[model samples]
Target: MTDTLLKTPLYQAHVDAGAKMVPFAGYDMPVQYGLGVKKEHLHTRDNAGLFDVSHMGQLRLKGANAAAALEALVPVDIIDLPAGQQRYAFFTNEQGGIMDDLMVANLGDHLFVVVNAACKEQDITHLQANLPEDVTLEVITDRALLALQGPKASSVLSRLAPQVADMVFMQVDNVSLMGVDCIVSRSGYTGEDGYEISVPQDKALELANALTAEDEVEWIGLGARDSLRLECGLCLYGHDLDTETTPVESSLLWGISKVRRQDGARPGGFPGADIIFEQIATKAISKKRVGLIGQTKAPVREGAKLFDADNNEIGVVTSGTAGPNAGKPVSMGYVKPEFAALESEVFAEVRGKMLAMTVSKMPFVPQRYYRG
Candidate 1:
């Protein structure tokens, strides 16, 4: 995976903006613009910020049984997904672990899927290996993905594509922006009201320039993107989640519809369904992912062990950051279910010292999605 560094269609655009380039998932990506991470993170919360996420993989799955085939991989009810609707899903391993988390959209004629850049190749392979012969997978490498996020995101985007102004959260549709055909989705990762646009690679720079030129939209980079998602209590792939983690253990049970669990419409169709469904009914999972707020300013990073009040090693921090909006250091980690109660006193082992932390609720900042 590290053999060659890949560049997105907007590579030159990022350099032109004076972005600090770094290697991410084998791609040369912008870590931060001159605005810096803190300001960019706050701007995306108060105003609008544009992100070049073209490094992620987009694919089209088609055929009469595409939904059914996709359901076999993830726990979500893709077959029940309405046209122009998007659903968050994860590819589960046979042993009940997650292969990767992804977003899937029912585009009527086909399924539009976006997977993490790090796991794209393996995700495609897994899908192809399990899907029926009739199902088809098409890698949409000709497109660039962009995310415009913040409270004012919609107002700015509406100026260029007013039709999307009516689109509610998790909705997707083909639209024209700057006279270029693109797929626009009413969703984002920053826990803010926003949209993700999939534009043709050839027009990537043109669209990036047009959007960033807007007063409300400033160019954001990977650094702000990470801190933003972290503050939102969202998981970053390869950090908060991995092949060793299961949806149940990660407290993602809400994503697994009841119809697929206990005595419902279609129970147990996907991989590890028995184990997952059993955990749902019995609540037997050992560890649960929880939010932690550092009682001090010292932020804990990944790999920091967590300890119970009794000084017993209980868990480890998976993702952490100085929560800009929360005005404190916040983190996400997995702990034994017994110690996961809200407000439970725990200690994070940071540099040989036990720092006080409390088990807090996620979305450290309240989510502001425009569901309507």
Candidate 2:
């Protein structure tokens, strides 16, 4: 690690656990630990895995008009977002392209926003420049974020704070865990029942230690994190999504709330609303994101050019991985509209060999979020 790389609150803990550190988003983060990536990935699927995600940006938006002010920047319905609930959203440009995806939680008195680590400064600037003067944007730098995920996540966390057991997916609350006041949310990047806890910087290591001490929980690193999210069919901001890719093209139309659509009650007030609405109305998108499952054992990786049976280049893979739980190589990529249909056969060029891939539905592994 270099002097310029920043370290999260759990840096020492990761180092002590024999984590192989690497630079990510300007932070010295752990890529894997003593367990290695494959085992860590399997452990999380079978039991529980604790991850240090404190490097991501967290901000608070305060004011009565905070929700309305925020609605103008994204295509989601912020005004109707219920208290103690969170929604997935993204920043869009005038061309209807996604800038960055984020999580917006309605925390009653204010809104708590968590953005991608790499786009922190840019997202902050975007919010500052567009939000009205009444909406106060407060950057949260004194907290550390931790994600405890897996089938046993709820049981492990509920042991510390029993009240969290009642919170379902997308629910957020301020709770006390081991005497530390923390923001707890029933959400995670992995398609598993999990809780994302934001603790004070000073208490982060303690909380992490307590979680890992559980028999079911082990410290996971960035390598497993990426594979987990990839298996979940989640988009990595700069990879699966980018400024030139609109939400429509990224297969993220579900993220746009119905109320913000052209025919909804309040519509067309957001940036690129016209373009998005037109795309929805006309279905004129040239390309779209689709899931690819490899027919052979070879892993089809990102940036691999996809082709049709006619040997014409159709698209490029945006994210790919060998899904441990799915027992196959899975990937997601953009393809011409005609090649984006389910069951459509496509080919990915890897090592000068054309690998057979099939367009399939995402979330290769079932999402095990706790709904009740």
Candidate 3:
């Protein structure tokens, strides 16, 4: 059983700081510190909060054919990505179904990849067998990830690393903060202005301590991270998306570049291209991932069934929560496209009670990303 429980470099620090640890994505991580989930969730929205995301997978893929080699596995037009820019993409199966969502950065000579914590090991193995022998897949397991997010995040980080304040969304730059060399990205899972910093594992604690030293900074845990991402309408890998779901049905067509969709005839040779391509041409997609606002206090959770007013089952809830930001229940799930309109009435079977809900626009709370 110990093999199932993974630990990040900050495991000891989490325990030392009195974090309420729990098993998540195979790692024993802090679900919440002494403040609990609600307080931590609000804290991140109102002020800058630090999150130890070391459990995420960081990899460096290097070789002459790196760009072309990776293009064969993912749908994004990686060759088009210029240096110092990053984009969100996914590892797809032959059926065009998503294996996992990932962020890829073209570092000029190589590709920098960050995948979900739960899918890291499998992702590494998949890349190893698929890429050309000349290309090397190097795992940066000795590094740690920290996300500093909120309106004041830039201000807090600027105090130590003044250059970060100028970074636009999705841009990456390598800089030093308080003498520690780091790669900072103006990106985050939550729809808020934030930075995801990659630092040496040994230096993680010191950096975290330094960031938290400011009056506006506090340590946040996974509990708040989940709620914040949900409020932002971001999908959680295992929950909102899965291997069985395709990008088209998941409302992620934007990830497929127009060049690949039109000029290339075939965007990528990754899994599921045929079906995905056919869907793009024929609009065979029957369902869509949409947001829901429940009228009752009961929080609809994963596995809840959805039905129409006549009580006809239409689809299943993939992810849901009583939104911390909305102060009411907000959820996301796939429903038949015919029933996915903004005002369509739907019911989520909550604890045997069919609660009323309406199909609503996402980002239940407006996104606060600093696009400029």
RMSD of each: 1.3, 0.8, 1.5
Off by over 4 Å in 3: 1-4, 263-266
lDDT of 3 by residue, 126-199 (tens): 99999999889999978899999998999999999888999988999787987988888999987889999999
Using lDDT, rank the candidates from best to worst.
2, 1, 3
User: What TM-score, computed on C-alpha atoms, does each candidate reach?
Assistant: 0.98, 0.99, 0.96
Candidate 2's residue-wise lDDT over 1-372, tens digit each?
A: 458999999999999999999999999999999999999999999999999999999999999999999999999999999999999999999999999999999989999999999999999999999999999999999999999999999999999999999999999999999999999999999999999999999999988989899999999999999999999999999999998988889999999988888888888788888998888878899889999999999989899999999899999999889989889999999999989889999999999999999999999999999999
Clashing pairs in 1: none
Clashing pairs in 2: none
By lDDT, who's the top model here? Answer: 2
lDDT of 2 at 196: 94
Expressed as tens digits, the lDDT of each residue in 1-372 for candidate 1 is 424789999998998999999999989999999989999999998999999999999999999999999998888888899999999999888778888999999989999999999999999899889989999999997999999999999999999989888999999999999999999999988989999999999998988888888888899999889889988888888998888888999988888867777586988788888888778778898789999999999988889999988899999999988988889999999999999999999999988899999999988998888987
Ranking by TM-score: 2, 1, 3
In lDDT terms, how accurate is model 3? 0.88
| Residue 274 local lDDT, model 2 | 91
Clash numbers, per candidate? 0, 0, 6
